[model samples]
Target: MTAATSISPIPVAPVGLTARARRFVEVDSVRVPRRGLGQHRRKWIEHGAPAVEIDRAAVFQDRWGGLALPPAPFYEGGPRILGAGCPEGSTDEGWSFRAGSCRVSMAYGFRIGSDGAFGIDAYRWTPLHASTDGWVESLALAAHAGRWAKTVTRIKGKAVESLDLVGFEPVPEVQGVTDTWWRGKDSLIALYRGEAVGLDAPRCLEAHVYGGLDEWGLHGG
Candidate 1:
């Protein structure tokens, strides 16, 4: 004989996503605190110099983990959410224009395949030709380094559909490139530099490669 029992169904919020995919992306140059346990330092020893000197300065790996939120439109006429795309409670949290001194921004998002493949998504970029103190100074710095000043251009809304357009060439033979990315208008760029370096780039890259396979539509096409 079997005993009769009553069961209740727990109400669950409908998952807002169609297919929860994970993406890792790197954004370069979000200022970090100059002093702390993880403050940056570098060392160099001249060939003829006596002792090696540690340059307790300049950029170092300050990467931290965060979440990749769905690409939502940032419209002046639409509702905007604070801390969009970041993990529920992470130090990497804030709204756009929340002062560069506070928190960093999401740089890029890339999908990682289950069999270990990956590609670029949206890019984060700012205009190069701005008439402001910050813009002029940034341009000057890049020129000083004999390089071009670059900012991740925003795509407004919607993630880029084509990976190839964002410099993710078909690497049928390689698992993944020692690559990084920065978001730009409707696309991302795969590279090691140009505001796509160190922590900003690697954290996002790792997310795609190791963090979010299922969410990124990895198993299938």
Candidate 2:
């Protein structure tokens, strides 16, 4: 008897995405406490705040696993839920923020220092942009980094001193570039040697390529 033959299904490609769609992005955020943790939580609860439950495993991976990229649409609109390392009943339970969509999935960790001060380390990502508008749209999507930082500050009743946007390009060693980092209209200040400098002054916003793939290995190193 002849051996049985098997057939393989043909592969299909995704529809509707253009060539300019962004396949990778990363942003790191930091915030400082402006008030005590208890006071902040009380204020948040008083305002009918939405609570974000901490996903312990997610937190561990984020703190130790580098960047964890979320699926499409990137930012999901809702209360900010961060991962934390604390006992169930501890006052230091994970934090939650008011719900809203910035078009990226955000994951972070909150810590209260020995001195009773608090801080946040956050990571945000999106797998694709799908925009036909070109680079400006990509930059605009990235500009949400500031807004995300500000939202966290508002929830924690803290001040956002600095938030940096670090672009992660899928391509190796090419270096991702953006026209402007800030989303909204704002002043750009230049300083040199403790004095104000012109826009023509040298300024560098660098991008470094870190070699690694997501858990799914969709992006090759």
Candidate 3:
């Protein structure tokens, strides 16, 4: 098994996303407490993430394997999930290896293909993005956009399909299939389709609209 799921296509962030992707995506930052165990530091460095992302004294490999909830859409996200995708063995698929357990199910994570991008680890080597930074950027956007939006309208079950995304532009930072984000003039629409697709439960489909936002809330630090 690798990071690709047979149900979905290979998630590619693509070279041309929205204008927001032109510059660095700003997300809500948080403090992560890492126990410095430098055992897997070398792999992290080799993975091509920024040196500042993980410390030399921090434990790199996941001593504790992440628990994947079969197939579900309720993947609670945070920077911690990245920690779950710890380094794993290597493969012939572009030297793909386990990077970290995403903590959002999909069997946690596997830094698939040559890009070393994080995603489900299975027969398919689909990646969440072209690089690790893209994942972080997408996660940050999800965390911050909801908080800033004054109104968060939720849609679930059959209602989720009714959401019209006519004017919204796809947010490519996440490069998600079941989970996706869209940007509108004054709002952000997020959809959680993991459960609906993974479990084959149409009612599990859910969506949210984050409306009423200013520049600061959307992208400002």
What is each predicted model's overall lDDT from 0 to 1?
A: 0.22, 0.24, 0.51
Candidate 3 similarity to native, TM-score: 0.52
TM-score leader: 3
Cα lDDT of model 3 by residue, 69-90, tens digit:
1222234442232343333335
Q: Each model's TM-score?
A: 0.17, 0.16, 0.52
Ranking according to TM-score, highest score first: 3, 1, 2
- 1-221 per-residue lDDT for model 1 (tens digits): 22223211221212221111101111221222223212212112322211211111111111111211122112111111111111111133211111111122443332211111222223532221111122212222222222222233322111322233443332221122333333333222333221233233432221111112231122221
Candidates in descending lDDT order: 3, 2, 1
Local accuracy of candidate 2 as per-residue lDDT tens digits, 1-221: 22233211221112322222223322222111111133344444455443332233232223322222232121132113222233122244334222112234445333322222222223311111112122213322333332232221220011112323233123312111212122122211111110001122123222211112232222121
Off by over 4 Å in 3: 1-74, 78-96, 101-115, 121-130, 175-178, 198-201, 218-221
Candidate 2 or 3, higher lDDT? Answer: 3
On the 0 to 100 scale, the lDDT of residue 97 in model 3 is 45
